[model samples]
Target: MKQRLNIASDTRINALLCSSAAVLLAACGAAGAASAQTTAHVYTMTGAASKDFALTGYDTNPLAGAGSLNGAIASAAAGAAGAQPRLLASVATANPSSSAVTTATTEVTQLYQSLLGRAPDAAGLAYWSQAVASGVPLSAVEAAIRSSAEYISLHNTAGSTVTVPATPYNYYVSPTGSDTAAGTKAAPFKTLARAAKAATRAGTTVWVAPGTYAGGIKTTYSGTSSARIYWVSTTKWGAKVVPPASSTNNNAWDNRGNYVSIIGFDVDGTNSGSGTKWTHGIYTGGSYGMIADNHIHNVAKSVACTSAGGSAIGVDSYYHGVMTDVIGNVVNDIGPAGCTYVQGIYFSTSGTIKNNLVYRVGAVAIHLWHDATNVIITNNTAAASNFGMVIGGGDFYHTSAGANNIFVANNIVYDNKYGISEQGVTGKQNVYKNNLIYKNTTYNTSLRNGLVATATVGSDPLFKGYSRTAAAPDFHLTTSSPAIGRGTATNAYPTDLDGKARNATTGYDIGAYQH
Candidate 1:
C-alpha cells in the first residue's frame, strides 16, 4: 500500500529527545522520499541519524502526483533553529549523483509549467534540475516560483496589485561540462553557446569559470535598462577566449544585445594563425551596454596590411541616444604595424570611452570614425601607434559635414607616429581641453578645421617606468609628473582605470592612472 510520511508532531518530540535520534531516523528514514505535505512548511535536520519533519500551512502545491526520492531521514525534521528547518523533499532522488535525472527534470519542468504557465528556459530548467538533484525540497522550489515576478504578473487580480521581484539567476560555464548538463555551478555548461542559450533573461549573470573557451561566441540576448545581463569571468582574466584555429567566426566576442555587460575576460588573438581570422577582439553592436575591465590584445592579421581588419574593442550603438560605454580596458598589440584602418579601441557610434590604456596598435590607438558623435574620450593613455588618436568621420555620413559635439579631454597622447589629431567637419562647441600632447613623431595637437585643444600642455608625463616595448608597461604617473593636477574638471572622469575614485578635494589627474 502507498503511504505518505507525515511528521508534524513527532519531529518536535524527536528534536526534544535527541537521544533517540538514530532510532527515530531508521524507522522514518523513508521520509526523505516525501513528495508532498504542507509543512507548517517547516523542516529541520539535527546533524544526527533520523528526523521527523513537521507539517503545517495550507496545501500550496496545486499539482498532485509528487515523486518519491530515495536518503537521509535526519533531513526531514521541521523548525528553523538550524540546517534542518527549511529543506522540503528532493526531486525523485535521494542523492545528487544518482540516476534520478528523469524525475529531477520532470519535476522542475512541471513547476515551470504549473507556476509560470510557460516552458522553463534552458538556464532556469538547469538550475531547478540541479537544485532538485541536490535534494532541494520541491516545496521550496514551488515557493520560489510563487515569489517570482512572472507568477505574480500572471495571477494578479484586476483589483489587486502585486509586486513580486524578478529572480536573479546565475548560470555557469566551464570547459569540463557538457551542453546538456544543468547550467549550475555544480553542473556548468561546457560552452558559451550553452550558457547563452540558458541565460536568456534580464538580470541573469553568466559566470565563466576558469578555462579556455573557443572564440567567436555571439551574445544575442538583451536585458532591460534597469536589469542588465552580465557575462563575467569568475577569476580576473582566468577565463580566456582564444581565437578558433579555423572557423567563420570573425569576432572573439560579438555582442548584439542591448544592456549587456561583458566584464573581466581575456580575449587573446595570439592563436589566430589559421582558419577564419579574428577581426574584433570584443565587439558590441548594442546600445545601453558596457564593456569594462577587459584585456583585448593581438587583434591583427598574419598577412600584410589590409582594410578588412577591425578594432580590438569596437562599440556600435544600434539605438541613437543610448550609449555603450567602454571603460577601464587595457588594449594593446591590436593590429599589424602601419595598418591605417586598424585600431586598439574604436567606436563608430556614441559612447563614453574613458580610463583606457592603448599601446602598440596598428593605426590609431583610439579612433573615433564613421558616425561617432557626442562621444566623450577622456582619462586615457595612448602610445606606440600610428596615431595616438585620430578622431574623424568617414564617408558613412556621406556629407561634407562631420560628426559634431565630440568631446576629447584629460588624455595623455604621447610617443606615437602622430599625436591627437582631428580630421573632420567638427563644430566649435566640441570641448577639446586639458590634454598632455607630447613627443610624437609628427605634430602634437593637429586641431585644424574648427577643432582645437585649449590649454594643451606639451610636457613629458613622467612615468614610474617608461618602456614603450615592454609587454607590461607601467603607465603610473610620478608625483612630479606634469600630467598630475593639470586636468580640467570639464569632462573629467570620476574614477581611474584601476577603479580608484579620484581625489575629491585634489584636482583630477590625466592619463589612465590618477597619480
Candidate 2:
C-alpha cells in the first residue's frame, strides 16, 4: 500500500488535502513581510514531576528521509504499507492563531499553544521544526503533540491533588571554608570544584560566596529536566571567576553538565597577563543548561590585539539538537579594541538567547556558527561592537551550515559598526524584524548575502541614556521612546535584563529594558 500526502489548500486545517506545487514554509517567520503581532503570554513548562514540555521532545528522532529533504524540498516517502498520508514538508493548513506567524516555527508554536497551552521552548521548537522541515505531516505532528505527557497532564481532570516537586538540597562554596568539609552553609566547601563534586544529585544548587575564585572550573554534573543542578552566586556578580595568573587557551568556566545552571556569577578575565589569552568567560556545552544573571566581561582583553580571539559567553551546540537558555546576562568589554575574532555571545543549534545586555564587545556581539539552526534571539540589547550580531553558517565558518526556523525579535541592536549581518548560502526562513537597529556606522542590516529581513524598526531607540564606552550605559526606555509598545510577543521574553517584568500597562517594548 502506498501513502498519499493530502495537504489541504485551504487555511483551515480540517484534513490533509493534495497539492502539486512545492509550498516552502519558513520554520521561523519563513514567509510574508507581515508585521509581528503575537499575543504576549507568560511562558510555562507544564508537565509531570518527571519532565517538562518546554525542554522535552528535543531529542526526538528525525524523520527517516530528513537528510534528503534538506537543500531540496521533497514529499514524504511513506513506508510501503497502507494508505496513510505522506509527510511532505511543512504542508500545514494554517491554524487560527492570534500570532501572525506563517512559517514552520509558527506551525509548531500554534500546536504547542493550542494543544498544550504553553509557548514552545527552544528545544521543542528545534526538534519539531526539524520534524516539520523533514516532511512530517501536520496531522501526525498534531497527534504527537496531543500524546505528549505535558498535554496529557494539562488535560488531566482526575480529581486528584497534584504533587508539587520539592526544593532541591543546597550546597555552599566559599574561599574561607575547606573542600574537606561537608558542603553545608556553615561548613561550606572551599572550591567550586568540590561543590561541583558534591552536587551530583538532580536539582542540587551550589551557592558560591562573594570572593574571587580561580578560573578553569569544569562542571560535569547531570540532572533531569525537572531537577537541574543550579550553580548560583550568593550575590549577583559577586562571586568572581578570574583566570589564574598565567593562563592561555583555557576558559574561565567550562560547564559541561546536562540540565545544569550557572547564575549570578561575575566571570572577569581582564586580569590575565597581557601575553595570556582565555578562551571564554562562561562556556556551557550541556543540553538544557541555563547561563543567566551573570556578568561576563573582558574574557581575552589582556591578550595582545592580534592574538585576542574568544567570547564572553559561549554556549557550544555540542549535542546538535539540545536547548540551552542563555538569558539575563551582561556580557561586556571582551577582546582588544578591534579584534574581529572575539565576540560577546557565540552559540549554535537550538536555544533561547534572551534578556541579555551585550555591550562594547570586540567584534560580532552575538554569533551563531557551526550547525546553527532553530534558535530564538529576543529581548537583547547589543551595542558598541564591530558587528551587533551575525546569524549564518556554512563555508564562511567551516564545519557549520544551517538556517532553519531561526527566530529573532524584540531586540535593540544599536551603535555598532554593522548591525545584524548574516552569512552562509544555505540559510533560509530566518526572521529579523521589530528590532531597534539604529545609529550604526555602516549598514543597519546586511542579510542580503544569506536571507533578507522582512521588516526593521529603524527608529532610534530613545534610551534613558546611551554611551558607547559602556561606562554608564543606560538602556531604559523613556516615555517618548520609539521602542515603546512596538515589540511583538513572538519569541519575546517576559522579563527584561534587570530581572524586571515588562511594562504591564503598555504592550511589549523592544530592547532589554521594558520600562
Candidate 3:
C-alpha cells in the first residue's frame, strides 16, 4: 500500500540546517565518497554542524544541480530532521569535475574579453589548449588565467620599471643622498648628481621629491627613447603655497652647463643670501633639450656680472644643440641683482617660449640679444615690467642680420613704457600680428619699432589677475576693453585659453589672450 506524506515546520527547519552543513563539507572535498551509513551520520549531526554555516572552502561549488552535491545535501538534511529512512534513500549522486575543462575555458575567455576588449592572441590561446589537454585541474586553470597577456597589459601605463622617490628624500622635509642607491621615498638622495648617475642606464627611473632644491644642480645623461629621467613634484602643486627659498647671497641655483632638465623646482634667488655675489636662479650654459614647467624667480643679486650682459634667467653664449622648449611657467618679482639690467627670460637662440606668465621684473621682461634666430614667442602675458619685449639681432628693426624669421605673435603687453622694441641691424623678416598693447601712462611714440605690422592701438588688454595665473587669463572684454574683434582672422588664434576652437566669423582678438 502507498503511504500519505506529512511534514511539520520544525522538521523542515531541521532538514534545511542539516543539508546546508553537508553541502559545505562536501564542497571542501571532505569525507570523500561517504558510504551510505556515514551519510546517515552526517544527517544526524546536521543541527550541530549547521551553526557554522558561514564557512566556505576553495573547492566549494555554490551552483545548483552540481554533481552528487544535491543528493549529499538532501541526505544530510533528512537525517538531521529525523525524517523517514526512505526519504534519505531517495537522494541522488553526481560528479561535477568531469566538465571542469569546459568551465575553465569559458572563464578564461570572459576574462580576456573584459580586459583587452577582444579575444586572446594566438600564443595565449595555444597555452590554454595545451594545459587543458594535459588535464590541468580547476586550480591550475585559475593560475593559467592569471598568467595570460591580458593581466600584464593592464599595467602598461607605468611603463617597464616602477618609479619611486630618490633615497633619503622626504616629501615633507629636506632630502640628502647620492643618486646611485635605490631612489626610495624615505631615504632620498639630495643631489641631482645622484639621480643622473642612475638615470643614464635604460629601464631606470629617478624620481625627485618636492622642495626648493638649491642651485648648482646639474646633470648630463642621455636617456633612451623608452626610458627618461623624470623630475616631478612629490605633492600636488608641489607645495606651491610656500614661496621659494629666500637667499641673502647670489645664484641660489645654477645649472652648470648640463644637457638635462632642471624642472619643477621653485628656486628662490631673493635678497642675495651671501651678499651681492650671485643673482641667477638658473643660469644655463652648455644646456640643451627642454626646460619646462618651472617656477623661477628672485635671483638678481647673485648675477652681478650682467655688466658682461647677464639676464635674470640668462641663456649664455655658444648655445648650439640647445634646442630647448620653455613653456607653462610663472616668473615674478625678478631682477633685483646688482646691475640695473634684468630680464625675465633672455634667449640667444632658435627657441620657443609660449604660454608663460611673467610680471614685475626690474628691467625688460623679455630680451633677445645676439645670434638669436628663428625664435617664436607667442601666447604670453607680461604686465608691470620695465619693458614688454626687447629684440636685437646685430640691431633690432633692421632684421637683416642673424635674427631672421622672428615671429612675435599673440601676446598681451600692458602697463609698461613701450610695448615691444625690435631695434638693431638689418635683413630680418619679422611679423608682429594680433597683439593687444594697452593702458600705459608712459606713452611711447613708436610701436613695433614703427614698423608696418598689425597691432591694437588704444585697446586695453584686460587681465584676470595682473600678478597671478595668466595661463587662463579671463580677458572677458568689458565695455571699455577696445580689444574685441580687432584681430586678423587668418592668424588662427585660440579664442579661449582652455583650447577651444575660436569662431572665425568673430575674427581673431588682438592679444595672446582672447575673450
Candidate 4:
C-alpha cells in the first residue's frame, strides 16, 4: 500500500497553525510543553536547529533565498495557495528526537570544560542534560556554573594554590663537590648550573648547600601542573648566588620555567657592572611560579639618560606569561647611585605579593606597572624607601599599559619619601583598604582619578619601639594602638606577619602585625 502525503497547500497550512500554537505554548506553559515548543519555535524561525543542519540542505534550497522561515510560516498561516510542507518537514527531520539529546549533551560538556577545567562526570553530565531537557536555558545553566565556588576558586589566580607532588625528586649542589658526581647528599654537584640541568622532570628539587656560587644561572626547564619543580636552599639565606663580572645584563638567577618555585636563597648582585644594561637579583618569567623566603639585595643598574634601572625581584612576562606568588622575602639596598626607577618587588602582570619586608630601596618598595592586574598586596612592611608602594604606570617612561583592579590592603608603610603614590591611567579602580600609612616626608596617601580609600588611617600606627634612625626597627603594634581591631574584618589574612592569628573575636588589626 502506497500512501502519498500531498503536502502542497493544506498540509503546510496545518503545520503553520501547529507552529503558531507551539510558539504561544513556549511563552506560557508547563515544562514538557515548553520544552517541545522551544524546539518547534527554533525550527520554525531558523529553518534548522543547528548550523550544520542549516548548511547541509537549507542553503542550497531554491526556496531558502531569504534564509528565514518567517515569510513561509506567515504565508502558510495566511492560507497562501503555493505553500509547501516539504520545507517545514525538512527542518523537522534535520532536528530529530535524538538531536535534542545530543544538543543537551554537547551543551553540558562544553559548560563543564569551560567552568571546571575538566569533562563532566557521568552523574554531572546526566544532571545538567536533564536540566536542559526540562526547559532550563543553556545561558542560565552557564551563569550558575560560573557563579559556583569551585569556579571562583579556580579562576582566582592570586589565591589559588600551587600544585606540588607529595614525594619530590631531589638533587643537591655544593661548593666543595664535583660536577661529574651523582647529585646526591654525599656526592653533590659543584655548580648550580649543573644541578639545574639535571633537575629536568616535574617534582624534581635542586637543593643547594651553604655556598657562594658565581656566574649567572639560567633555567629553561618546565614543570607540570600537578608536580611543580623546586629549587630550595638547605638553609634560608645560606646558599648565595653572585653575578660574575663578565655578565653583560647582570642577573644572578634568570628563571624562565612555568610552575617552578625559587625558595630560601640569598641572591646578591653587588658586582654588576654599570651600564644601561638591565640588572636584577632574581628575574622571573613564565607563570604559576613562586618566589618565597629569599634574601635579595644590591642589584641595580646605572641610571640612563631617559629610563631607570631594573628590580631586585622582577616578575615580568616578556613572552605573555601570567600570575606569580612573591611572598615572605627580604629585599634591601637595591639601586645604583642616583637611580630613582629601581624597585624591590616589580611586577608587570597578575600576582600575590605579601608578607615581604623591603628597606632602604632607591625607588618604590613595591611597584605595579604596565598592564598589571588582579594583584593582591597584603601584610607587607616597607620602610626607608623613596616610596613605600607605587601603583600605576611610571609617568616618566609613559608606560601606557597601566594597572587596574589592584588590591592594596593590610600593609605597613612608614618613613619613606612618599608613603603611597597613585598615578597614570591604570590608577583608576584601585582599592586602598585597611592600610597603616604614616610618617613619610611628603604625604601618607596620594590619590588621582577619583580613587578613594576604603578605610585608611593616616596617623602614626604606634609600634612597640620604632624609630627612623634605629638599627633594627620593630613594627609590632601596642595594645592601645588605634590600628587594633580597626581594619575591615573581611578578606584579612588568617595569620599576620609573625604567623599569628589576625583577630581573636573583635576585629582585625591594621598593618603587618596583629595586636
Models 1 onward score TM values of 0.67, 0.65, 0.55, 0.62
lDDT of model 3 at position 486: 66
- Model 2, which residues run further than 4 Å from truth? 1-167, 246-249, 273-276, 305-308, 319-321, 395-401, 449-455
Over 296-337, each residue of candidate 2 has an lDDT whose tens digit, in order, gives: 887777566664357888877654436888888888888877
Question: What is candidate 1's CA lDDT for residue 508?
Answer: 79
For candidate 4, the lDDT comes to 0.65
User: Candidate 1: where is the Cα deviation over 4 Å?
Assistant: 1-167, 317-322, 397-401
- Clashes found in each candidate (C-alpha, N, C closer than 3 A): 16, 10, 52, 1
lDDT of 1 by residue, 1-515 (tens): 01113331223222211222222222322232242222223333332323333322112331122321112232342332342334444233234554654688799787675555456666455544644665556665565455444444333312111111233566778999889998876788999877877878897777787789988888889988888887877666778989766767778988888888887778998876466788789988888888877889887655456777588998864334258888888899887788887789887777788889999998899987777777899989998888998777765543345556888888999999899878765555567788899999888887766555787878899988888789788899999999888887776667787766676467778888998
Flag clash pairs in model 2.
6-16, 6-17, 7-17, 8-17, 26-30, 26-104, 27-105, 28-405, 89-135, 394-400
> In candidate 3, which residue ranges exceed 4 Å CA deviation?
1-181, 185-187, 201-206, 223-230, 234-259, 275-277, 286-288, 301-306, 337-340, 395-400, 440-450, 455-457, 465-515
Our model 4 lands, by Cα RMSD against the true structure, at 19.4
Q: Regarding lDDT, does 1 or 4 come out ahead? A: 1
RMSD to native for every prediction?
A: 13.2, 20.1, 18.0, 19.4
Q: Write the per-residue lDDT of candidate 3 for residues 259-291, one digit (tens) a residue.
A: 444445565555333334444555655445445
Better of 2 and 4 by TM-score: 2
Weakest ten-residue segment in model 3 by summed lDDT: 1-10
* Whole-model lDDT values for every prediction: 0.69, 0.65, 0.46, 0.65
